[model samples]
Each structure stands twice: as C-alpha cells, then as structure tokens.
Target: MSVKFRPLADRVLVEPIKAETKTASGIIIPDTAKEKPQEGTVVAVGPGKKDEPTTVQVGDKVLYGKYSGSELKLDGKDYLIVKESDLLGILG
Candidate 1:
C-alpha cells in the first residue's frame, strides 16, 4: 500500500476491514444495523515515542477495540489513527 499520508509520533494508520453483512442463512443485513469493524490491516505506522517503539508494522492485520482510534478518510477509503496501545494484537 502506498499512502501519501504518514502518521507521526506513535500514531498508526489502519485500513479497516468491513464487517459481515450477511448471515449464515444468507440473510442480508441492512446498513443501519451494521456493526463497525474491529479488525483492520495496518497501512502505515509512525516512529514510536521516546523509549517506546511501535510493535506493529505495515501489512500487519490487527485486532482492536470496537471503539478505538479516530476515523478519517483518504482517497475515498476509510482509515483509523490509533496509538500502539490501542491495538489489541496481531492476527496470524
């Protein structure tokens, strides 16, 4: 991923994964009831603050809290900017 926007000082830019929109039975879920995704791929990461380096890196798929990070849009795609602490863990 080549994002022009780079995060600074412990901030990370993440591309959020979309939540499931259908059930196992093939039921289509309406937009109004869709849950915000809690998983995403780390697109960019900033240099860590003094004495603490960032643990995650670009292309790392991570899980986070449901209400973590600030949301923003870049080139028509949604992204989140969160501190390294906000990320729960990296996915396999």
Candidate 2:
C-alpha cells in the first residue's frame, strides 16, 4: 500500500508473493518447518519498455523463475526487481 519503487525502464519492482505452506516426502510441512516464501506481494511495477510492451501491472500476481533476478531487502523484507521478461507468468 505504501510501496515506492524507482525501477529502471523495462523492469518491474516486485515483492514476490510467498506461499504459506510447503510439502515434502509425502508429508505436510508445519509452519515452522515451511521454507521462506519464494513469492510475495507486488510492491511496485515499472513502466513497460520497448515497442511491443509488457503487459504486467502493478497489482498483478506473477510468477518468476526460481533462480531469476536479483534480490533486495526493503524494510526488513525481501524483494525483487526483475525485467518484465523475467516474470514467468501472471496468476489468474
């Protein structure tokens, strides 16, 4: 709600949405055992660059590659500002 990002052109400032749960070895993971969320809220989005343009929006839920992009910490929380091409897909 109070997100401020000065993303470079053609890039998006995202707080990857974190999943609340995890499962492994055919067992459910407890909250304590669950891994840190790889996904998070979309903090800020940059203006699309290039002629064709990117379709991602500021509030759109998106999926990015596991090892994609750089990581940054804001207000003690982690965030990523990757290129629009880095986003894997938008959540429906």
Candidate 3:
C-alpha cells in the first residue's frame, strides 16, 4: 500500500470503507440508497502541528464524520483527506 501522495499539516489520507450492501436479514441494498461510510483505513498521515504530533497512524481503522474530508481519487481508488480533528475515534 504505497502511495505517492502525502498529507501535510495535520491532514490524513483515508481510504473509505464501503457501506454494507446487504442487510442482516439478507435484503440487498441499492447503490443509490447506500449511505456514505464514516469508517476508513488511514492510508497516510501528516506530521502534527508544532507541539503536537499526530496520534493516528497508517493502517489504523478510524471513524469520522460523514462529510469530514475532501474527496480524492488516485489510480481509480477513492480517498479522503481530512484533518485530524475530523476523525472521531480509532477502531479496533
């Protein structure tokens, strides 16, 4: 998972996790009805601001706001560049 792009100044590069396409009852969800996923894997992280180093690392699964980051596409893969503050929490 090597990326040519690197975030700067507290920004994080995240690869969004796709929303569930099927319900627990085996009902299939339509693409248009699917909600944007708030969970993602951290692909790249920027150095923290002065006196504060970034806590999240690459490959960390995290939760963020539904509309937190700017959308990006590289090599046909969707990504998000959000501020560290936009991230809600780290996922196990």
TM-score of each: 0.96, 0.71, 0.95
Model 1 stretches astray by more than 4 angstroms: none
Candidate numbers sorted by TM-score from highest down:
1, 3, 2
lDDT (CA) per prediction: 0.93, 0.72, 0.96
Give the Cα error of residue 5 in candidate 2, in Å. Answer: 1.7
What tens digits encode model 2's per-residue C-alpha lDDT throughout 13-77?
A: 78866655645556667777755544545667666676756677777887887777788987777
- Writing each residue's lDDT as its tens digit, candidate 3 over 22-91 gives 9999999999999999999999999989998999999999999998989999999999999999999999
Per-residue lDDT over 1-92 for candidate 1, one digit per residue giving the tens place of the 0 to 100 score: 79899899898999999989998999999999999999999999999999998989899999999999999999899999998899999999
Kindly report which residue pairs in candidate 3 clash with one another: none
Considering only N, C-alpha and C atoms within 3 Å, which residue pairs clash in candidate 1? none
Report the number of the highest-lDDT candidate.
Answer: 3
lDDT of 1 at 14: 92
Q: Evaluate model 2: give its lDDT.
A: 0.72
Output the lDDT of residue 52, model 3.
89
User: Relative to the unseen true structure, what is the C-alpha lDDT of residue 74 in candidate 1, on a scale of 0 to 100?
Assistant: 92
